[model samples]
Target: MTQQTLQRPSGWIERSRPAVQWTALIGLSLGFGAVLFWLGVPAAMLIGPLLAGIVISGNGGKLRLSRHAFVPVQGIIGCMIARMLPSSTGGELGIHWPVFAAGVLSVIVASGILGWVLVRMRVLPGTTALWGVSPGAATVMTLMAEAFGADAQLVAVMQYLRVLMVAAIASVLAKVVGANPHHAVAAVTWFPAIAWLPFAKTLALAVLGPLLGQRLRIPMGPMLVTLVAGVVLVHHGWLSIELPRWLPAIAYAFVGWRIGLRFTRPLLAHAARALPRIIACSLALIVVCGAIGAVLVAVAGVDPLTAYLATSPGGADSVAIIAASSNVDVRFVMAMQMARFLAVLAIGPATARFLARRATANANAAAAAAASSTDS
Candidate 1:
């Protein structure tokens, strides 16, 4: 009958709201699955929830469009554009130091600038903005954000959304210019060899990445782990892994559903005040990065569009899809995409720590001033 006893039970009930959580989880899963089915695997590369997150997070408008609806439309447009890029181009654009340096520089500079703007505006916390604008894999950002105590979900969503938008726009432009986007040719089937080495390596890397992410406080643990492992496997010739036909679609759907779920009125209100700045900063970064990437492509004597897609801040899968469809070197595109992703993932936590430290120092200074005034 005591007041404390009554309050404790109510708090426990609220915490144990299994029904609501389950509903959200199941709804998200199904919604994501449906999006994959609707868009088809190849098209879904840009249709995922992460892509939706960008639009949702960057939405400055009053009207609320369901991410579910928007992602598919975007994907369709992206796919159409991807279908227009050349299926094969001359080999003049081989990877080299200058090209690599340009890509790296663009990503770093753009990501830093966008992160600084977002944090200064207070639309999002510094760490969250850094992770969100890191221009890496969505999963990497998420894991790093979690380790750094930023809102991982928000960062992941926003980063993915930007990827979708960029991919869609890029693809469309490529097609409009009369590029030849070709479908992937079916590979010769090899009998499944019972190779334990590849599977074991992949599993080990996956586990290790998360552990390192936890210890080092990296974001998007699973993604970082898988990407690193995948690269190692490919490099060692232990695995000739290609993304499954269904994966891009599935990834996009899950991303889209996750984004849609965050579309509540209250969150929208908060995003409104700072949405314009966030969008402007992100767009500026993209344009600058794209221009640098274009220069690198021209210097390397490679197709400009391929280089642009590779260095673009869009998701790796989407870029890969565009590369594959357009006859660009899939391996080269994936390699660069992975490199960019790793760069963003690795830097996110460090950037966050630095910003957080500065913020803490300022707060401490303010507190000291307040105490001195009180004494006076």
Candidate 2:
């Protein structure tokens, strides 16, 4: 009843605000994700939470998922990708190595060119444009963007924008080409049968790998370290990785929240201004990659659908889903996608760095020239 009691209630309300906001955000994300999943959208869980996060941030919500939590989540994602890329694809690669090489190189180059154009046109600043257009898995590229000094928020926008566009286009293409993808991809059971020993081992690797990487202060360390270890373990048959469905969903949600909750009004405005250019660049990359697919059809003697699916610029898992349903050579499609992923992981960093430096130097030069002319 006194002043102190009134102050205590106000403080308690302030303290509880974040909890309440997070609850609403989570509920909204799950609802969004559920709808997208029903529609068979690829990466629906991540995208749903991301959209929900953006909406929350826009509405003046103030809460962030901690970096401590986000880092381990990245490691989990890396482990997921490692397990997803099949080791058995090596045989297909051996047989069609030339075609696969061409397809991979073509897509990477096409994406890089588009990214550079975006930078040149000032559509997006610096290496954000480059990383955004990089043809790796959208989530992986989004996670790695901040480490490489790109705007992770804008990159997330660009990467996921492309993911949705590419997935929608691929679905339409699959349908037009007479591929019935209905029930092609199986729904993941919420609680699948578990191998506890392997699951525990995988979990330990996901948690510890990132800790080690962070301790060593490696850039993008968490995901890279876990990815390397996972590839080694899985390739050598030293370990069989197992993860529950919910763990990844949680990871994706947290990452979504982390990226989403950071948006400012100004940045949102900048994103809006850049949206049309982003769309055009994304479409250009898609069309170029489709042309590469056409090359594969002609030279590799693969079907048009297989060729298109193989050379799809991003969203390897999504492409895999479509491939599973079609009459395409599943092994060949997977091998191509895996090879491109590996190539991106290997070459993407150096490419991004080089392009970033180039972009920086050019901007510096332009500014200097303007100053010199003004002085003269």
Model number with the top TM-score: 2
Return the lDDT, model 2, position 69: 74
lDDT tens digits, residues 14-84, model 1?
34454554344444455543454243333333344444433333332122345343433333222322223
lDDT, candidate 1, equals 0.54
Per-residue lDDT tens digits of candidate 2, residues 1-376? 8888775232332345787878878899999988866766545666677678777766666667777978888788768766765766556568768778888998898888888888888777667888888887566677777886678878877776676577567655665673644533364567888999999999999999999989988556787678678878899998898978778777767666665665644456667877887788778888888999988888778888778778877555455545543456766776677778888888877887688779878988999999999999
Query: What TM value does model 1 have?
Result: 0.54
Please state the error at residue 334 of candidate 1 in Å.
1.1
- The local distance difference test score of each candidate is 0.54, 0.74
RMSD per prediction, one decimal? 10.4, 7.2
